[model samples]
Target chain A: MAIINYANKEVQFKIVFYGPALCGKTTNLAYIHSQITETNKGELVSLATAADRTLFFDFLPLNAIVIRNFKTKFQLYTVPGQVIYNATRQLVLRSVDAVVFVADSQWDKMEENIESFRNLDENLARQGLSLDTIPYVIQLNKRDMPNVAPIHYLDFILNDRAVCVPSFEASATTGQGVFDTLNTVSRMLLVKFARDAEAAAYVKSQPTPAASPMDGVAAGLRQPQAAR
Target chain B: MQSTPIVTIAAAEKFLKTLEEFLNHSEAFFALIIDRGGTILSQSGRPPDGTDITILAALAAGSFAATRELATRVGESEFNALYQQGSHFHILMNAVDDDTMLVTIFSTQTTVGLVRFYSARTSEQIAIQMQELRADCVDAPLVFTEADLNTASQIFRDTTDKAV
Candidate 1:
């Protein structure tokens, strides 16, 4: 959901980071929060267990871009990736504008990656949304690990979706490729807004069709249906 | 939730003003209206700088969400109100609508009974207006041109910094 606050001249969007357990979803957000200046970011909040595992979600609010005299803000969130946290993940995914699928690139984690990807699609569908149409990117994370799989194979498996979205090789722990992933997704969301605005303009310019006698009867029928 | 519940600046400010009046009568420290996603829509009677209102809003929303689950597991529909007692101050939260929450903070000067009684009345009054505001929210279309995109891209230019 994008918030257009006319009073404050601010536009806000929600972007969620999702993936399998221990895929560095939280690390990506921590890196971004640390890199940005205090004036450009908000306090990063994490609800986790004693072992530092995410219990529900992590949130970091970033405000930097200015569009059309309005402050463009992005509320970044990371869902709990553990398998048992599926219900919590579904709750966070609601009203999302975009998603960043952070995949663990180690050879041993491929199965977990694939299962999480499928779960993303299923959860999205339950909300009447489709991952195929939503603006998203793939972050192949943990590339610094020795057991990591090759980028080509990772892409062949995860990135081979209907649209073949952008993919980045990232070491989230070291902050490699984190900003790149954020920048691209934010740009995509802005572009999407532009396209939607254009479509709205085109619709407004179109002439209304002439109404026939049946139009009144049809409207009368709708009144009773609406009252019921 | 296909259409975003647009909280216009005008609507939010009006809401805050109303809540502020209630805070005065109830001798409350502050009041905050938050969206379901944990964004602070409006706030009244500011707390000290040491209190991060943004973080407070997020945590309050999270707590309310977890409580909602607990209510359902106990074979209840949902718990519309929550109260937490601190050392010197007490907090009360209520649902203004399905997508919004109202939180009031007060010290020992006020009683929980008074806050709870007045909060329910205020929530009902605010919920009626919120329904009307949400109806007009989606109608305000965002009209962006090429210039907006160019400016947006150039403004966030520091995203490439590799600092961790």
Candidate 2:
């Protein structure tokens, strides 16, 4: 969920990088953390195992842009891509506003990529969302490697959505196409947030109907009276 | 299905004041009200040198989530609070509501019992205000023009170009 704080003059969005294990999900984050100015980026926190595989998640917060007099901040996160960490991944996706589906470009990893994509869809479905509902972009990672799948073939399998969202070809370790992917997803998230805010304003401007008995009950139910 | 929560100027001021009062009473060096998603909503008191409050908020939220999971695994629905005692500093995190938590950093000088007592009261006050804020939240709508979005995109491009 995007938190727009008029008081603080700040708008915050959560963007998650998701893909299969060893698909350079952590590499994308590490490269960005290294490139971004220190003042604009926070410490990159990763909870991983002894082998450095992501056990929980990796987090990086960036505050670099201002839109409409509001300081725009993006909290970038990557879920543990291993199959056994589905629970941790779901926890990290709790309130994500956008996603970057980093697909491994090697031909042999196609099945893993497909399974991860389906997993993403299933997790979002559990939250009452879908790829169509949330703004997401695709990244064909490790393009610099040999024996990579053809770009057209990758698109045929993954980008065959109702609307083909933006996709980039990149080598995360060397920092190729990293910012392009980040910038595009960030822009899409900003635009969607703006449109949603406008729609909310439109609804709020409508006339309010007379309050009924059910209205009070509904309001009561909405209150978070419990301590926890 | 809930709309995105907005912290208006009035609400923010009230929250800061509440936090400051809690700090004064509890003698904690820092107090932060962070959302469940780990975004710092309102914070008060001076942090210790070399303390990254942003990262601290994120880690606190993560730790709290992990604790909740542990609670569930142990047959409890949830744990309302988490306390960590360090050599010189003690941190106490209490649940304010479903969407936010209260975190305080205190020295060994202050008793944990006092911190807990004040935290419960402060959290209750914050919970009421948060409930009221959610019930009737009205702030200026965030309307972005085409020029604004273009400017934002250009900023990103410029930053990326410079970094590269």
Against the hidden reference, what TM-scores do the models get?
0.90, 0.90
Measured over all alpha carbons after superposition, the RMSD of each candidate to the real structure, in angstroms, is 3.7, 6.2
lDDT per residue as tens, model 1, A1-228:
676777777777889999999999999999888778789888999988989899989988888677667888888889999999887888788668899999999999999999999999999898888877788999999999999999999999998876899999899988888888988888888788778767777786788998798999888887755554
lDDT of 2 by residue, B1-164 (tens): 34446787778998999999999998888999988778888999988788888888888988888888888999997798999999999899998887889999999878999999999999999999888788767656654644578655443442446323
DockQ of candidate 2 is 0.40
lDDT of 2 by residue, A1-228 (tens): 888777889888899999999999999999888888778888999988999999988999998687767898999999999998887787788778999999999999999999999999999887777899799999999999999999999999999988999999999988888888998898888888887777878888898987798988899899988886
- Pairs of residues clashing in candidate 2: none
Q: Flag regions of model 2 displaced more than 4 Å.
A: A208-228, B1-4, B153-164
Error of 1 at A120 (Å): 1.7
The reply for model 1, stretches above 4 Å from the true place, is A201-210, A214-228, B138-143, B154-160
Clashing pairs in 1: none
Query: In model 2, what lDDT does residue A155 have?
Result: 93
